[model samples]
Every structure is written in C-alpha cells, then in structure tokens.
Target: MMDRTDRHCRYFLRQISARTLLYTEMVTSQAILHGDLEKLLGFTPEESLIALQVGGDDPARLAKCATIAAEFGYDEINLNVGCPSQRVQSGNFGACLMMEPERVADCVAAMRSASNLPVTVKHRIGVDDHDHYEHLRQFVEIVAAAGCQRFTVHARKAWLKGLSPKENRDVPPLRYADVYRLKQEFPDLVIEINGGILTLDATLEHLAQVDAVMIGRAAYDNPYLLAEADRRIFREAVAVRSRHEIVEAMYPYID
Candidate 1:
C-alpha cells in the first residue's frame, strides 16, 4: 500500500465512503522529521478521522513524529511493524521491529506521551521462525501493556530474507485465526484484521469475529468496492454512488 495509498488515491476513495477510516500510506519517522513537512503530513479537514502511519525504531524521533501528527490533526498515529522490504529491515524498522517487542513498546509509550492522538501499531502476526501463536500473543501483550489499545494486525508472517516485498505479501499464508484468537483473549482491545479481505461479504465475515477489518490493496485496486461501505459497514443509509457520479464528483478536486 506504499505508492498505492497516496493523497490522490485516498481522495478518490474518500468519495466512495465518507465514513470509513481512511489511512495514509506508511511514511517513515525519518521522512516526517527531515523531509517536506506539508507533503508528508498535510491533508484537508475533509479527511478527518484519518490515521497517519509512521515507520521507525527510534523512540524519540517517533515521539516527535507523533507530536507533528497531532498538530496536523490526525485522529490517530499508527506505527508500522509490518513491511518486510529489505530497505525497511536495513533501517531497523518495519517487520523487523516485531522481533523486539520491548522496543516497540518503548516507541509506543514515547509517542503516546508526546501527543493526545491514539497510538496504534500495525504488525504482522509473526515473522520467520517466530511464526507461532504464543509468540504472537506474547508480542501483543508486551506492546499492549505499554498503552497501545488498538492494533491492525496483518494476518501473515513476514520472511525478511526469502521474498521480495510484493511476493512477501502474497506467498505467506494468512493465519487469520491467530488474529481472531488475539481478540478472544484480549477482548478489551480494538483488534482490526488486515490481509486478503477483498469483498464486503468477506469483510462482514471477519467482523463477526474481530472488532474491525482493514482492506488495503483490495480496496485500492478496485476502490468502488467501498462505494457501499458507508451503508454496509457503518449502517448509514446513504445511497451508493454510481461510477459516473463518482467521477463527476471528483472533477472539482482534480482541477
């Protein structure tokens, strides 16, 4: 969802579902700290309830990024511990951070201290040899103890060595059961499941067991799939927009 969920893509999807919580693509703490501030953190007030997902292993820098996100009016701050790319691993962040849950906890605690926005973590179920439910559970507990109340868990383990980032997304089998069980045990926390959920019916099915479902590439690939999301997912009575109407609606923004 890197290049896929940029500002233009998110703006287009926003026309489809006014109520769904749209997410910005992962922007590393380094980028937010040193790169173009407005380009990295800016969004219209129309994009309310949106979350800015940041990547990094540095507690101080992530805390600074969290403060910026709050000043920029992001409703939530998400720490990315799910990308399995070599660049991410070399940077000592992303999926590699999952192995060091205590560090993830420290980063979470630091961010929460710096801002009032909700601090959350999006992580893989497991990684490489740590692909077991107990390890996943332990990782969640340690991080949750640090005050991360919501977690968007990708239901696959990451292979830091064997696969390309694109292949890593598909080749690893999704173990949604691990996510469901995480909810069962930690019923108090908000557990949103992500990975391979492509259809509304599939979304409903996951919602039966988990608190929420996150559709990434599936929603981005055919954004219209969320045309009825406000009605179906949020129980709003809004009419679904037709393809033509949706495009026409986007004209002003395109200008």
Candidate 2:
C-alpha cells in the first residue's frame, strides 16, 4: 500500500494482515537526503512487509537513500516513475523520467548496487503525448538491461500539462493490452500490471495475462477484497479471514 496519505490507514492495515506487503507513500530522494530521514520513514517493524517508494532523478542521491532505507529495515526499495503530478514533473522525476530510459536504468543500477535488498520500478506506459506501445517497450528493454528485473507498469499514459494527479488516475483511459504484450515480450522478467484493477475478478483476469496485479485504490477502499486475494492468487494454505475478524486480530498488536 503506497501513495496513501493517511497514517491511520497504515495503522489499520497493519492490524488486518501481517503477511501482506506494505509500502509507504512516495518520498522524494531530496526528503531523505536533505530532510529528516527518521521522521519520513519511521514505522514499527510489526507493520508487516514494508517497502520504501522513492522519487528523484539523481542516481547517487537515490542510491544513498536506498541504502538508508535498507538500514531502516525496509524489505524492498521501489522507485516511483509513474506519478503524473506536476510538482513531481517539475522535480524532473515521476512520469517524465519514463521518457529517459537510460537514466532510469542508471538510477536502478545505482540503487541495486547500493543495497542488498530487491530494487523494483513502478512506471507509466508513456508520459504526455508520447503514448505508444513501442515507447514503453524501449523503456522496459533498457531498464531491464540495466539489471532491474522487477517492473510494475501502470497501464496508462500521463498527460503532463493537462491532467491533475487525481484526474490522471481516472480521466485518461487505461490501456491494459500494452501491459499484457510487454509481459509476452519479456516473459523472463517479472511483470506486474497496475491501474484500474479493482476487483478480485479483475485481478484474476489480469493475472492470466500478466505475472502479477498491483491494486491501489481498490485495495484501500474495499479492503475486504484482500480476504480472497492471498488464498486464490498467492496460493497460501491459510484460509481467508473475515474482515471483521481481521480488524479484531490486529487491534491487540497495534495497541
């Protein structure tokens, strides 16, 4: 769970599923390097599987922050190259970074070399008006060659100048077909699809086409949906817990 604005949500979620992976809201590299590192990423270890989502174009700063995240005991480190926020764009990161695959590759390589934990990337298909399957293919190709194998693609293009971040997630149409094709082209790579995947059925459908499905809004809104997620998708032997029971189970730990 990343990009969420509420700390209450994180506390509630940690109460629900200790086995599920969790992510912090995207923190810029400058925040980690120049700002307060302890305050930005501080959390309890019992918050389940945690990953830090970083935003920045500078490779050295990004790597240094990744090392800090590792020292903070983050299970994995993810780079956010998919956000369409104008503020993020002005910072020369986010969706705009997708236009520079070589730079993204270098950023990933630096992060990977800095820490022992897994380095992953979450990106958009394309940015602004440059929406094309080939463009996404090239971006993935170069990044994969740079030693970052895990990718989560938001199946949409980001119109940098027009859409607001909220509108970017909704207004622009989602193009899931391109993501499926990318998976077919790079079967060796671990490909996960994001954007507009709301229901368990939708995730199932996408999983048939890609290696994994990443849920954001849906997972946060209808959290009960995850009741069936682990058993069905991850093939865990544990039975799905009722949402009410999940809450109760987590209450004691959080208290």
Candidate 3:
C-alpha cells in the first residue's frame, strides 16, 4: 500500500469506519531517519488504530525508526517481508528476507527493544523453491521467538526469479490453506491472512480460521466496502453513515 494508503486516503476511510485498523505505506527506515519526517510519518490523531510500516534490513536503522514511530503516536510498527518489488529486493529486505529468518529475528528484537511498542511482521509464506510448511513454520518460530507475536501473511509464495511484482500478486496461487494450517499449529500467535480477500463476508470467514484479515487492493479499489465495517466487523451499534454524507464530509479534507 506504498502510495495507496496515504494520510488523505486514511482520513477518508476513517470517516467510514472508525474501528478499522489502518496502516501507512511502507516507509524505508533510512527515510524515517534522514528524510522529511513530517511528510513521511505525519498522521492525524483521528486516524487511531493506525500502524506505521517500515521496510529495510538494517536492524539499527529499523530500531531507530521504531522509536521515531512510537513518538509520532503510531499504534503499531510493521516490518515488511512480503513485498516482491524489485526495489525492495535490491534493498535486501521484503520477501527476500524470508531466506534469513535469524536476520529477521535480529531486526525484530532490535525494533521491539527500541520502542517497547507492539511489533508485527508482514511476510509471504515462502520464497523461490522454499515453499513448504516447514519453511514457513521455521520462519514464524524464529521471528516469534524474537517477540513478534503478530504476523500478517500474504498467503502466497513470492517467486523472486521471473515474476514481476504485479504478476506476483496474481501469479502465485494463494495457498490460504497454508495460512490456515499455520493458525492451527500456532494457536497462541496472532495469524492474520492477506491476499485477494475482497468482501466483509470473506473477511469474517477467514476470521473463523485465523485471528485477523488484511484487505489491501480490494479496500482501496472500492472504499465504500468499508462503510459498514464498524457495524458488521466490529459489531459497533453506531449508525451507518450514507455515501452522500461521506462525500460531503470528505470535501473539506479533499481540498
């Protein structure tokens, strides 16, 4: 959600569902450390239940980024290990890091210790020929041991060799069963499944098997999909606001 879930988009979504958790586009740890912090990390208090997602391989820089994120009032810090973009791969992070569980462990531990905030990881099930249950389990165990209790898995193995990033999202068959099995084995950890989930009903169905569901393109493509999220997903009794009211509400923010 690099350019998709920006502050403006989040504010729009907030007017729809106050309870839905939102995340920032992945900001590089180096960017947070040296770039314009406000532009990179700024968000409104109204955007509660929000998380800051960072991408990088340096444990020290990520740890620093975590501390900065906490000070900026983010509810969670998410490490990206699921993205298959060539840009991310060249940086030595993203889906490629699945091959280095211990290194991921070190980065997680460093971030956790730095901010003392809730740390989560988003990763694919596997990479290259390493797509196996044991491979996923080992990766999860190592990171979990480093105190990352929550993992958002993009239920597909990332093919780093031939597939382009766009193809990656569609090419690799979604092995949701693999994610379901993960939740079964590690019942104590929070396992949230991602990848192609498009409806509130589908989200609810996945919740029956896992702890949570993360919707990306689906939600962004048709944000009205979130209008009933509070009442339907969170079970809040608040009245559902109409589309006209939402559009009127967003006019000022859009300006």
**Tens digits of lDDT, candidate 1, 1-255:** 688777777788888889989889899988998899889878887766699999999999999999999999999999999999999999999999989999999999999999999999999999999889999999999999999999999999999998999998899998999999999999999999999999999999999999999998888778999998899999998899999999998999989
Colliding pairs, model 2: none
For candidate 2, the 10 contiguous residues with the lowest summed lDDT are: 1-10
In model 2, what lDDT does residue 219 have? Answer: 79
TM-scores of all models? 0.99, 0.93, 0.98
lDDT of 2 by residue, 104-194 (tens): 9999999999999899899998987678898999999999998888899999898888788889899888999999999999999999999
Estimate the overall C-alpha local distance difference test score of candidate 2.
Answer: 0.85
Look at candidate 3 and tell me the lDDT of residue 95.
94
Whole-model Cα lDDT per candidate? Answer: 0.93, 0.85, 0.94
Residue pairs in steric clash, candidate 1?
none
The sequence of per-residue lDDT tens digits that candidate 3 reaches over residues 46-88 is 8888999999999999999999999999999999998888889
Better of 2 and 3 by TM-score: 3
Per-residue lDDT of 73 in model 2: 91
Off by over 4 Å in 1: none
